[model samples]
Target: YGAAEAGRDYNTTDMSRQRMYNEYLPPYKAAVEAGVGSVMSSFNDINGIPATANKWLMTDLLRKQWNFLGFVATDYTAINELSAHGLGDDKKVSELALNAGIDMDMVGEIFLRNLAQNIKEGTVKQADVDQACRRVLEAKYRLGLFQDPYHGVSEARAKQVLMQPAFVQAARDVARRSLVLLKNDNQTLPLKNTANIAVIGPLADRPLDMLGNWSGAGDAKQAVSILQGIKNVGGATIRVTYAHGANVTEDAQLIARLNEHGGQLDIDPRPADAQIAEAVAAAQKAEVVVAVVGESQGMTGEAASRADIGLPGRQLDLLKALKATGKPLVVVLC
Candidate 1:
């Protein structure tokens, strides 16, 4: 959050041999030694060649030197984008990648579309293709896929195994451990049951935001939101009020981008000043105010980047308004 100077962007990385081995190769080597089932080549090029078509890095270094017998998969359309990296066309790149060590293609049909042609032209050998296929089949054999691919995968099985007592306890443990409290002075917590508490911000009652990104198989509706937690934890005697003080951001382009895959954040449709006023009013009538703020799930993870990683939208303004109320305020970054 503007804590340091911005570093220069090296769009295409070009590093010396010593730096490559010292910085990057060690981790790959460790993974290989740890018996990793497969390796996915990254999008960026190293030195002068794309990872998808780097024979020195893949075959000679990974397979021969390190004895990594597992198959190497291409990251998304890395093989197809070889041309974009100024390497070659589809057929040419396919040949290069296959010869290099890419046994599996992820999301791109470059190999499926061009491998036969490459073989006919004698650019890729039958032996090389056979080697790749053997490694892939070997992996499948290890997984017992040849016998039964869908073993232990059924509704009845899921019901029997999922969310068992031990798993639930583990989940609770992880949740507790994940919490990072930066500040909590003057015994702000353990709220007095008779106190009137106002919970503010759009995030306070948003169950979807609690699920986070890549919540694989997790249902957002099942999550207990911040408002619910506060109400439940504070018990029956605590009078609580809620106000959606601000949306995650006011930028229309950002909202659209975040919702491109799905609606991770919902903007209030109501005017900003009106929301702030409601929050301020809530704070005015409360003994203590709890403001739920910070990132929506889509603001982080792969392909998501930020130049100024501060509190998004008019949340700062919302906090300022609540602060003006002169009530004891608790800031909770979700």
Candidate 2:
């Protein structure tokens, strides 16, 4: 992505060719030379041109200059999205992408739909289409897909390996290692064995949410929600209480938009003040409070661009109420 924000897809990057050649192109050059099988054209523009439809990027730099032998695939409907970037409509994008040396489409079948007709109309060259086909075929050959289309397919193997004890332990270790400590004033962490803690937030007990956006074929019920996780780690050594602080948002528009993509963040039917009072009561009883709240997994990832990045809805209000409680507070932005 070139100078892109989550809110906007297209943005130009001002750069010098010297800096681009030296700083940016080396890793890609290395990957090509290392015989990587494929390259994915990103969903952002470079120098006011969308990468999927930029001939200089997909063809000139990647293939002619760098001599990359592998095929180039568009990043998820990026080819079809050229119009959104002010490039053109579907047929126009298909032609532009093909001419730019894009070999495969991810989900958007613009290439499949328009390439042959465009070639017949002399808008797209047959040679370009042939080259793209050849590159993709060569990649498949390298992967032995022709020899065995079912090479790695396994149903029983999945059950055998998924949630395996060793794998689970490894995942836990990785998660532990990945945690970044932002601030720990006065050594506030390493909670006292006898600490009374209140865990409050919409995400605190959301088991399904604990398993992020890409938990393929995995059961979210097995996921450890923040409240459960705190209890598990604290054990009988510490006392813990929980409250459903507030739903992710009260804004009807956001709720509607999220639900459009099956991003369901339930608007808690309970009155907002009542919810806050409950959370406040929990906070008042505890020596420390852990507030787990923020973007649901849906408010992130593709197509979920947020212009306002702060705590959405009345989340800040909840935080303010918690702050007034004056307990040692730990905020986890999930």
Candidate 3:
């Protein structure tokens, strides 16, 4: 599919060729081996050459050495950022990237704006442009897009398959196996069905957070929150209580940026102390307390970073409060 700089958008990836081959290259190589239709160039430099304009990477390693036939597309605005990376101006960078082996310019109209003029000026060869276009067309042809652009996408089919029972069960099965149980003391393994359980945290009942970052076309409503999943498995016999112990963060700037696209942050307006008090109250009454806490949905994905990567806002306080309750504490990080 695509790659990122150090698995984060726009982050710097500085490493030796030996290290890249040993660690970073393997995944992309494997993807190439699997016949991925296209490879998106990362937003970082490879040995001081920005990936978008790195001929050695896109041409020598990816195409000639690895035998990757798919076209290379630039990550969002990556080609344009060559100027920011001190490579060149728009026209210069665009031509450089295209010659270097970038076949598609994603969200940056550098190619659209300058490639023709560059070709006329003999700055970029028409054959190189033709070659790039051929690769992209070949990928599209292989995907059967040329034959039927819609490719069987329909509202009826979407309704039939989206969150289908079989798919949901498969997801649940995968999720169950993916969980890593780091420790279990005093054989306090699975709780008895009769035990009272308190599921407390900002994320416990948050369906939106369950979908996670980059959940394309996946509806939050289709996701089963931790609270819902517990309730579903526990049935009517087991007691289950829930409390949102804290907002994901109280940072106004972060919240504003997070809400810019729409209010995905889900920052609770209640006072931090009030939220902590409620959680502590729930913990006091329950036989076992499950405190769900961690980075909010907006905190981990593209263009998002934290100077202090600990628990955000009063989540630490809520956790400390829950710990002091002396109830069996089960901490779940989102």
Candidate 4:
């Protein structure tokens, strides 16, 4: 149930929304072709209502039109999410969910809370309910859940799968390619061998923020942090220093949330003055100041953006201060 807006923000213009919709349809159609069994949409409300209750998305686009042979599940309580999106009251939201062909509602209390009234009001037709239930049953049948739900479990298979060389290689390739090179001025593409160098930044020494949203399957212990990567590339001797410098934001509430959810990238968002002082101190002492700054993981990704693009809090002040140190500043904006 992902929103149609592209480029990490939900305030997509009408023209941009149409373009994103066009881009989104083809991949979904391909997934159907690959014989997918079920589709669970996302948490963000798409357009007006959450994608879970959006009939236009599940029914019109995926089921009736694309002929997807899979049951559709909402991101989470899409019915309740409708209320949050300000689409309608609870009863109306439940009616919308069934009509939209959501086979199973997750966390949406409407199915349990107000279904009877929805059915009585002519707001939802019985046929729509039946269709959704039928789709769920079909999915269960295809999965052999009714026949033998536990058919595919085996210790031997699990061991063999883990040992598969191809899977290992694929994982390695994914890890390597996922790294985005932020700067390579004058073909400094591959880092040169230098005996003494400083890896300075709040984020440079940390690994947790590398994976953003929906990073459901990664092991923090298994991931290589930026600092770790540098150490592994032993061609050059490296000197590394980490400064938590400033928190990602100055807002106390925002910092508290980031502390819970953000990896290394998230920190105790501090006052602008604090951040600027730390950054300026570091810059004054360094030959090159690699100033990594931006919104924290919670600040600007999926459904996050600002009318003002300038750095939040006193971070911009920190940057200005760093520039005053006269060290070359190379910033990495996420």
lDDT of each: 0.84, 0.83, 0.85, 0.65
Candidate 4 per-residue lDDT over residues 110-200, each given as its tens digit = 7777776877898888777777779889977877989988777789788788637898689778967976876666553454554433444
Tens digit of lDDT per residue, candidate 2, span 228-266?
Answer: 989898888888999888888888877887788666566
Where does the lowest 10-residue lDDT sum fall in candidate 2? 2-11
lDDT of 1 by residue, 1-334 (tens): 1111132221356767887688757877898999999999877676667788899988899989999989999888889988888878999999989988999988899989999999999999989898888988999999998899986689999988787788878987898799887877788765654468999997899888888766778777767899998888878778999999999999999899889867577688999999999899989999999999988877865456677878899999999989888888899887
Q: Give model 1 RMSD, 1 decimal.
A: 3.3
Top lDDT model:
3
Better of 2 and 3 by lDDT: 3
Clashing pairs in 4: 1-41, 1-42, 45-50, 77-106, 77-108
Model 3: per-residue Cα lDDT over 1-334, one tens digit each: 1234446666566777787788777987898899888888877876677889999999999999999888889999889999999988999998889989999999999999999999999989999999999998998898899999999899999989877899999997998898887787765567765468999998898888887777777788778889998899889877899998998888989888778855476667889999899889988989898888987687887677676879988899899999999988888888
Q: Which regions of candidate 1 are displaced past 4 Å?
A: 1-14, 190-194
**Backbone clashes in model 2, listed as residue pairs:** none
* Model 3: residue 230 alpha-carbon error in angstroms: 2.3
lDDT of residue 169 for candidate 4 = 83
Each candidate's TM vs. the true structure?
0.89, 0.90, 0.90, 0.71
Candidate 2 TM-score versus the reference: 0.90
